[model samples]
Target: MSDPALVTIPARRGKAARVKQGQIVKVINTHGDQVVDTWAFNADDLNEFMSMEHTRPHIMKIMPAVGDAMLTNKRRPILTFIEDTSGGVHDTIISACDRYRYKFLGVEGYHDNCTDNLQAAMGELGLAAPETPCPLNLFMNIPVHADGSLSFEPPVSTAGSYVALRAEMDLVIAFSACPQDILPINGVGHLPTEAHFSVD
Candidate 1:
Protein backbone atom coordinates (compact mmCIF):
# COMPACT_ATOMS: atom_id res chain seq x y z
CA MET A 1 0.00 0.00 0.00
CA SER A 2 2.58 2.64 -0.70
CA ASP A 3 2.71 4.35 -4.10
CA PRO A 4 0.00 6.94 -4.29
CA ALA A 5 1.55 10.36 -4.39
CA LEU A 6 2.06 11.31 -8.00
CA VAL A 7 0.52 14.76 -8.32
CA THR A 8 2.20 16.76 -11.08
CA ILE A 9 -0.18 18.02 -13.83
CA PRO A 10 2.44 20.55 -14.87
CA ALA A 11 3.36 21.18 -18.48
CA ARG A 12 0.98 24.05 -19.09
CA ARG A 13 0.16 23.89 -15.39
CA GLY A 14 -2.77 23.39 -12.99
CA LYS A 15 -3.42 20.99 -10.17
CA ALA A 16 -5.76 20.66 -7.25
CA ALA A 17 -6.75 18.24 -4.56
CA ARG A 18 -8.92 17.66 -1.50
CA VAL A 19 -11.19 14.73 -2.21
CA LYS A 20 -12.85 12.58 0.39
CA GLN A 21 -16.07 10.69 0.07
CA GLY A 22 -14.78 7.40 -1.28
CA GLN A 23 -11.54 8.92 -2.68
CA ILE A 24 -9.74 7.51 -5.74
CA VAL A 25 -8.64 9.90 -8.42
CA LYS A 26 -5.90 8.16 -10.48
CA VAL A 27 -5.90 10.31 -13.75
CA ILE A 28 -2.40 9.81 -15.12
CA ASN A 29 -1.89 9.94 -18.79
CA THR A 30 1.70 10.62 -17.73
CA HIS A 31 2.94 10.99 -21.28
CA GLY A 32 0.08 9.58 -23.23
CA ASP A 33 -0.34 12.75 -25.15
CA GLN A 34 -1.66 14.80 -22.30
CA VAL A 35 -5.13 16.34 -22.17
CA VAL A 36 -6.36 16.36 -18.60
CA ASP A 37 -8.70 19.29 -17.98
CA THR A 38 -10.94 17.65 -15.43
CA TRP A 39 -12.78 19.44 -12.65
CA ALA A 40 -15.05 18.98 -9.68
CA PHE A 41 -16.20 20.97 -6.68
CA ASN A 42 -18.78 20.92 -3.95
CA ALA A 43 -16.40 20.48 -1.01
CA ASP A 44 -19.45 21.62 0.87
CA ASP A 45 -20.80 23.57 -2.10
CA LEU A 46 -18.72 25.87 -4.16
CA ASN A 47 -21.93 26.22 -6.10
CA GLU A 48 -21.78 22.51 -6.61
CA PHE A 49 -19.53 22.17 -9.66
CA MET A 50 -18.87 19.21 -11.96
CA SER A 51 -21.38 19.07 -14.76
CA MET A 52 -20.73 18.20 -18.35
CA GLU A 53 -24.18 19.46 -19.13
CA HIS A 54 -25.38 17.53 -16.16
CA THR A 55 -23.19 14.60 -17.14
CA ARG A 56 -24.61 14.13 -20.60
CA PRO A 57 -28.13 13.64 -19.39
CA HIS A 58 -26.95 11.57 -16.45
CA ILE A 59 -24.67 9.32 -18.48
CA MET A 60 -26.79 8.51 -21.45
CA LYS A 61 -23.33 8.67 -23.02
CA ILE A 62 -20.91 10.88 -24.86
CA MET A 63 -18.02 8.79 -23.68
CA PRO A 64 -18.13 8.05 -19.94
CA ALA A 65 -18.20 4.29 -19.52
CA VAL A 66 -16.67 2.47 -16.58
CA GLY A 67 -19.69 2.70 -14.37
CA ASP A 68 -20.50 6.37 -15.10
CA ALA A 69 -21.80 8.56 -12.33
CA MET A 70 -20.50 12.10 -12.72
CA LEU A 71 -23.55 14.35 -12.27
CA THR A 72 -23.63 17.51 -10.19
CA ASN A 73 -24.97 20.80 -11.40
CA LYS A 74 -27.44 20.04 -8.68
CA ARG A 75 -28.19 16.81 -10.46
CA ARG A 76 -26.16 15.10 -7.74
CA PRO A 77 -23.65 12.21 -7.90
CA ILE A 78 -20.26 13.96 -8.33
CA LEU A 79 -17.76 11.52 -9.88
CA THR A 80 -17.53 7.80 -10.39
CA PHE A 81 -16.28 6.61 -13.73
CA ILE A 82 -14.49 3.95 -11.66
CA GLU A 83 -11.52 3.28 -14.00
CA ASP A 84 -10.44 3.01 -17.58
CA THR A 85 -7.13 2.32 -19.22
CA SER A 86 -7.59 5.47 -21.30
CA GLY A 87 -8.83 4.64 -24.81
CA GLY A 88 -12.32 5.11 -23.61
CA VAL A 89 -11.93 8.17 -25.82
CA HIS A 90 -13.25 10.90 -23.57
CA ASP A 91 -14.55 14.39 -24.34
CA THR A 92 -18.11 15.16 -23.48
CA ILE A 93 -18.15 18.10 -25.85
CA ILE A 94 -15.19 20.51 -25.66
CA SER A 95 -15.10 23.91 -24.02
CA ALA A 96 -12.11 24.54 -21.79
CA CYS A 97 -9.16 26.07 -23.62
CA ASP A 98 -9.61 29.72 -22.93
CA ARG A 99 -8.02 33.14 -23.31
CA TYR A 100 -10.71 33.36 -25.90
CA ARG A 101 -9.72 29.93 -27.07
CA TYR A 102 -6.17 31.13 -27.81
CA LYS A 103 -7.59 34.06 -29.63
CA PHE A 104 -9.74 31.99 -31.88
CA LEU A 105 -6.92 29.45 -32.24
CA GLY A 106 -4.75 31.96 -34.02
CA VAL A 107 -2.87 32.80 -30.84
CA GLU A 108 -0.97 36.03 -31.10
CA GLY A 109 -0.01 36.15 -27.45
CA TYR A 110 -0.44 34.46 -24.05
CA HIS A 111 -1.64 30.93 -24.57
CA ASP A 112 -1.47 28.29 -21.85
CA ASN A 113 -5.16 27.80 -21.35
CA CYS A 114 -7.62 25.32 -19.91
CA THR A 115 -9.50 28.22 -18.68
CA ASP A 116 -6.38 29.61 -17.05
CA ASN A 117 -5.44 26.24 -15.80
CA LEU A 118 -8.67 26.04 -13.96
CA GLN A 119 -8.32 29.36 -12.23
CA ALA A 120 -4.71 28.65 -11.37
CA ALA A 121 -5.64 25.32 -9.94
CA MET A 122 -8.30 26.73 -7.76
CA GLY A 123 -5.94 29.42 -6.61
CA GLU A 124 -3.54 26.88 -5.22
CA LEU A 125 -6.15 25.45 -2.92
CA GLY A 126 -6.85 28.80 -1.32
CA LEU A 127 -10.09 28.06 -3.20
CA ALA A 128 -12.01 30.11 -5.77
CA ALA A 129 -13.50 28.49 -8.90
CA PRO A 130 -17.21 29.06 -8.74
CA GLU A 131 -17.70 29.08 -12.47
CA THR A 132 -15.52 27.41 -15.07
CA PRO A 133 -17.30 24.12 -15.20
CA CYS A 134 -17.59 21.76 -18.17
CA PRO A 135 -14.54 19.64 -17.93
CA LEU A 136 -14.02 15.88 -17.57
CA ASN A 137 -12.19 15.92 -20.84
CA LEU A 138 -9.51 13.52 -19.67
CA PHE A 139 -7.65 12.10 -22.68
CA MET A 140 -9.75 14.13 -25.06
CA ASN A 141 -10.23 12.92 -28.61
CA ILE A 142 -13.30 14.81 -29.80
CA PRO A 143 -14.57 13.04 -32.92
CA VAL A 144 -18.24 13.00 -33.49
CA HIS A 145 -19.51 13.69 -36.95
CA ALA A 146 -22.10 12.10 -39.16
CA ASP A 147 -23.52 15.53 -39.43
CA GLY A 148 -23.65 16.53 -35.79
CA SER A 149 -20.05 17.64 -36.30
CA LEU A 150 -17.05 17.85 -33.98
CA SER A 151 -13.49 16.94 -34.71
CA PHE A 152 -10.24 17.78 -32.94
CA GLU A 153 -9.02 14.24 -32.63
CA PRO A 154 -5.59 13.01 -31.54
CA PRO A 155 -5.24 11.24 -28.23
CA VAL A 156 -6.30 7.64 -27.92
CA SER A 157 -4.22 7.54 -24.76
CA THR A 158 -0.97 5.58 -24.84
CA ALA A 159 2.25 6.13 -22.92
CA GLY A 160 0.97 5.22 -19.48
CA SER A 161 -2.78 5.50 -19.75
CA TYR A 162 -5.18 5.90 -16.87
CA VAL A 163 -8.47 7.29 -15.69
CA ALA A 164 -10.29 6.69 -12.49
CA LEU A 165 -12.67 8.66 -10.39
CA ARG A 166 -14.85 8.04 -7.39
CA ALA A 167 -15.30 10.88 -4.97
CA GLU A 168 -19.05 11.25 -5.17
CA MET A 169 -19.26 13.82 -2.44
CA ASP A 170 -16.62 15.94 -0.66
CA LEU A 171 -14.97 17.06 -3.87
CA VAL A 172 -12.57 19.71 -5.22
CA ILE A 173 -10.53 17.84 -7.85
CA ALA A 174 -9.36 20.19 -10.54
CA PHE A 175 -6.62 19.40 -13.08
CA SER A 176 -5.51 20.76 -16.41
CA ALA A 177 -2.30 19.92 -18.16
CA CYS A 178 -3.91 20.92 -21.41
CA PRO A 179 -2.17 23.88 -22.97
CA GLN A 180 -3.53 22.83 -26.34
CA ASP A 181 -0.93 23.86 -28.89
CA ILE A 182 -3.59 24.83 -31.40
CA LEU A 183 -5.81 21.78 -31.67
CA PRO A 184 -5.03 18.21 -32.63
CA ILE A 185 -6.45 18.01 -29.19
CA ASN A 186 -3.01 17.61 -27.59
CA GLY A 187 -1.03 15.44 -29.96
CA VAL A 188 -0.32 15.19 -33.66
CA GLY A 189 2.88 16.86 -32.43
CA HIS A 190 0.97 19.87 -31.20
CA LEU A 191 2.74 19.09 -27.92
CA PRO A 192 1.37 19.96 -24.48
CA THR A 193 2.72 17.44 -22.04
CA GLU A 194 2.69 16.64 -18.35
CA ALA A 195 -0.09 14.96 -16.42
CA HIS A 196 -0.54 12.85 -13.34
CA PHE A 197 -2.73 12.37 -10.29
CA SER A 198 -3.32 9.91 -7.51
CA VAL A 199 -5.49 10.48 -4.43
CA ASP A 200 -6.42 7.00 -3.31
Candidate 2:
Protein backbone atom coordinates (compact mmCIF):
# COMPACT_ATOMS: atom_id res chain seq x y z
CA MET A 1 0.00 0.00 0.00
CA SER A 2 1.05 3.62 -0.52
CA ASP A 3 2.39 5.71 2.39
CA PRO A 4 -0.06 7.52 4.57
CA ALA A 5 -0.58 11.25 4.02
CA LEU A 6 1.39 13.61 6.22
CA VAL A 7 -0.43 15.46 8.94
CA THR A 8 0.75 18.95 9.71
CA ILE A 9 1.27 20.11 13.28
CA PRO A 10 1.11 23.79 12.49
CA ALA A 11 3.65 26.22 13.86
CA ARG A 12 2.98 27.05 17.51
CA ARG A 13 0.01 24.74 17.45
CA GLY A 14 -0.95 21.15 18.23
CA LYS A 15 -2.33 18.09 16.47
CA ALA A 16 -3.37 14.55 17.41
CA ALA A 17 -4.35 11.27 15.78
CA ARG A 18 -5.32 7.75 16.71
CA VAL A 19 -3.14 4.74 15.95
CA LYS A 20 -3.83 1.06 16.31
CA GLN A 21 -1.66 -1.42 18.11
CA GLY A 22 1.46 -2.32 16.12
CA GLN A 23 1.12 0.75 13.86
CA ILE A 24 3.93 3.21 13.47
CA VAL A 25 3.80 6.96 13.84
CA LYS A 26 6.54 8.95 12.16
CA VAL A 27 7.08 12.46 13.52
CA ILE A 28 9.06 14.80 11.29
CA ASN A 29 11.03 17.85 12.29
CA THR A 30 9.87 19.74 9.25
CA HIS A 31 11.78 22.95 9.99
CA GLY A 32 14.59 21.45 12.11
CA ASP A 33 14.08 23.69 15.18
CA GLN A 34 10.54 23.16 16.35
CA VAL A 35 10.19 21.04 19.50
CA VAL A 36 7.25 18.70 19.43
CA ASP A 37 5.85 17.95 22.85
CA THR A 38 4.37 14.48 22.45
CA TRP A 39 2.00 12.42 24.55
CA ALA A 40 0.11 9.13 24.25
CA PHE A 41 -3.17 8.13 25.86
CA ASN A 42 -4.99 4.84 26.15
CA ALA A 43 -7.93 5.01 23.73
CA ASP A 44 -10.03 3.01 26.15
CA ASP A 45 -9.03 5.13 29.12
CA LEU A 46 -7.76 8.67 29.05
CA ASN A 47 -6.68 8.46 32.70
CA GLU A 48 -3.72 6.33 31.74
CA PHE A 49 -1.48 8.49 29.60
CA MET A 50 2.23 8.34 28.90
CA SER A 51 4.18 9.40 31.97
CA MET A 52 7.77 10.56 31.72
CA GLU A 53 8.50 9.93 35.38
CA HIS A 54 7.25 6.37 35.09
CA THR A 55 9.04 5.78 31.82
CA ARG A 56 12.43 6.99 33.05
CA PRO A 57 12.81 4.17 35.57
CA HIS A 58 11.10 1.68 33.28
CA ILE A 59 13.52 2.33 30.40
CA MET A 60 16.41 3.22 32.76
CA LYS A 61 17.15 6.37 30.75
CA ILE A 62 16.25 10.01 30.92
CA MET A 63 15.13 9.77 27.33
CA PRO A 64 14.18 6.83 25.23
CA ALA A 65 16.38 5.21 22.59
CA VAL A 66 15.50 2.92 19.73
CA GLY A 67 13.75 -0.16 21.18
CA ASP A 68 12.81 1.59 24.42
CA ALA A 69 9.18 1.34 25.33
CA MET A 70 7.49 4.47 26.61
CA LEU A 71 5.31 3.57 29.57
CA THR A 72 2.05 4.98 30.78
CA ASN A 73 1.23 6.37 34.22
CA LYS A 74 0.11 2.91 35.15
CA ARG A 75 3.47 1.56 34.01
CA ARG A 76 2.21 -0.23 30.94
CA PRO A 77 3.94 0.02 27.57
CA ILE A 78 2.19 2.40 25.26
CA LEU A 79 4.61 3.28 22.49
CA THR A 80 7.94 1.86 21.50
CA PHE A 81 10.74 3.75 19.79
CA ILE A 82 11.49 1.88 16.62
CA GLU A 83 13.62 4.37 14.67
CA ASP A 84 15.31 7.71 15.19
CA THR A 85 17.36 9.77 12.74
CA SER A 86 17.18 13.01 14.71
CA GLY A 87 20.44 12.56 16.63
CA GLY A 88 18.65 10.75 19.47
CA VAL A 89 18.28 13.95 21.50
CA HIS A 90 15.02 14.39 23.35
CA ASP A 91 13.81 15.67 26.76
CA THR A 92 11.66 14.03 29.42
CA ILE A 93 12.17 16.21 32.47
CA ILE A 94 10.82 19.62 31.65
CA SER A 95 7.13 20.18 32.23
CA ALA A 96 5.06 21.40 29.33
CA CYS A 97 5.03 25.19 29.23
CA ASP A 98 1.76 26.63 30.39
CA ARG A 99 0.15 30.06 30.80
CA TYR A 100 1.64 30.21 34.28
CA ARG A 101 5.10 29.71 32.86
CA TYR A 102 4.72 32.72 30.57
CA LYS A 103 3.54 34.75 33.50
CA PHE A 104 6.59 33.73 35.46
CA LEU A 105 8.64 34.88 32.49
CA GLY A 106 7.00 38.29 32.94
CA VAL A 107 4.47 38.08 30.15
CA GLU A 108 1.63 40.41 31.13
CA GLY A 109 -0.98 38.74 28.96
CA TYR A 110 -1.70 35.39 27.39
CA HIS A 111 0.90 33.28 25.64
CA ASP A 112 0.44 30.14 23.61
CA ASN A 113 1.98 27.14 25.32
CA CYS A 114 2.30 23.41 25.01
CA THR A 115 -0.07 22.59 27.86
CA ASP A 116 -2.91 24.44 26.20
CA ASN A 117 -1.97 23.17 22.78
CA LEU A 118 -2.34 19.60 23.97
CA GLN A 119 -5.86 20.11 25.26
CA ALA A 120 -6.86 22.00 22.13
CA ALA A 121 -5.59 19.26 19.91
CA MET A 122 -7.43 16.56 21.82
CA GLY A 123 -10.50 18.69 21.92
CA GLU A 124 -10.62 18.60 18.15
CA LEU A 125 -11.11 14.87 18.38
CA GLY A 126 -13.89 15.18 20.97
CA LEU A 127 -11.56 14.18 23.74
CA ALA A 128 -10.01 15.85 26.77
CA ALA A 129 -6.74 15.07 28.45
CA PRO A 130 -7.45 14.27 32.11
CA GLU A 131 -4.14 15.80 33.01
CA THR A 132 -1.08 17.16 31.25
CA PRO A 133 1.53 14.58 32.08
CA CYS A 134 5.12 15.39 31.25
CA PRO A 135 5.43 14.80 27.51
CA LEU A 136 8.11 13.16 25.45
CA ASN A 137 9.61 16.39 24.25
CA LEU A 138 10.56 15.28 20.73
CA PHE A 139 13.77 16.71 19.28
CA MET A 140 14.13 18.97 22.30
CA ASN A 141 17.71 19.44 23.45
CA ILE A 142 18.16 20.13 27.14
CA PRO A 143 21.62 19.43 28.45
CA VAL A 144 22.18 18.12 31.97
CA HIS A 145 25.38 19.47 33.43
CA ALA A 146 27.89 18.02 35.86
CA ASP A 147 26.76 20.57 38.44
CA GLY A 148 23.33 18.95 38.39
CA SER A 149 21.85 21.82 36.51
CA LEU A 150 20.01 21.78 33.21
CA SER A 151 20.09 24.14 30.27
CA PHE A 152 17.62 24.48 27.45
CA GLU A 153 19.46 24.17 24.17
CA PRO A 154 18.50 24.15 20.54
CA PRO A 155 17.43 20.97 18.83
CA VAL A 156 20.12 19.07 16.92
CA SER A 157 17.71 17.57 14.43
CA THR A 158 17.97 18.72 10.83
CA ALA A 159 15.09 19.51 8.58
CA GLY A 160 13.01 16.45 7.65
CA SER A 161 14.62 14.19 10.23
CA TYR A 162 12.10 12.05 12.03
CA VAL A 163 11.51 9.47 14.73
CA ALA A 164 9.35 6.41 14.24
CA LEU A 165 7.37 5.06 17.18
CA ARG A 166 5.19 1.98 17.13
CA ALA A 167 2.04 1.89 19.16
CA GLU A 168 2.02 -0.84 21.76
CA MET A 169 -1.65 -0.37 22.34
CA ASP A 170 -4.56 1.24 20.53
CA LEU A 171 -4.11 4.86 21.57
CA VAL A 172 -4.31 8.54 20.78
CA ILE A 173 -1.12 10.47 20.15
CA ALA A 174 -0.87 14.21 20.65
CA PHE A 175 1.83 16.66 19.62
CA SER A 176 2.52 20.33 20.09
CA ALA A 177 4.88 22.26 17.86
CA CYS A 178 5.98 24.02 21.01
CA PRO A 179 5.35 27.76 21.04
CA GLN A 180 8.25 28.64 23.23
CA ASP A 181 9.78 31.69 21.59
CA ILE A 182 11.08 33.05 24.87
CA LEU A 183 13.57 30.23 25.33
CA PRO A 184 16.17 28.54 23.16
CA ILE A 185 14.55 25.13 23.43
CA ASN A 186 13.33 25.43 19.86
CA GLY A 187 16.53 27.21 18.74
CA VAL A 188 18.79 30.17 19.39
CA GLY A 189 16.65 31.99 16.88
CA HIS A 190 13.77 31.58 19.32
CA LEU A 191 11.42 30.81 16.48
CA PRO A 192 8.78 28.11 16.51
CA THR A 193 8.08 26.20 13.31
CA GLU A 194 5.76 23.58 11.95
CA ALA A 195 6.22 19.79 12.12
CA HIS A 196 4.69 16.79 10.36
CA PHE A 197 3.75 13.21 11.17
CA SER A 198 2.36 10.14 9.45
CA VAL A 199 0.77 7.01 10.90
CA ASP A 200 1.29 3.73 9.13
Best prediction by lDDT: 2
lDDT of 1 by residue, 51-99 (tens): 8888898778788889989888889998888879987898878888788
Superposition TM-score, candidate 1 onto the true structure: 0.32
Instruction: Tally clashing residue pairs in candidate 1.
Output: 1
Error of 1 at 86 (Å): 25
| lDDT, each prediction | 0.85, 0.94
TM-score of each: 0.32, 0.97
Query: In model 2, how large is the Cα lDDT of residue 174?
Result: 99
Prediction RMSDs, each to the true structure? 15.9, 1.8
Please report the candidate that would top TM-score against the real structure: 2
Q: After superposition, how far is residue 11 of candidate 1 from its true place, in Å?
A: 1.7
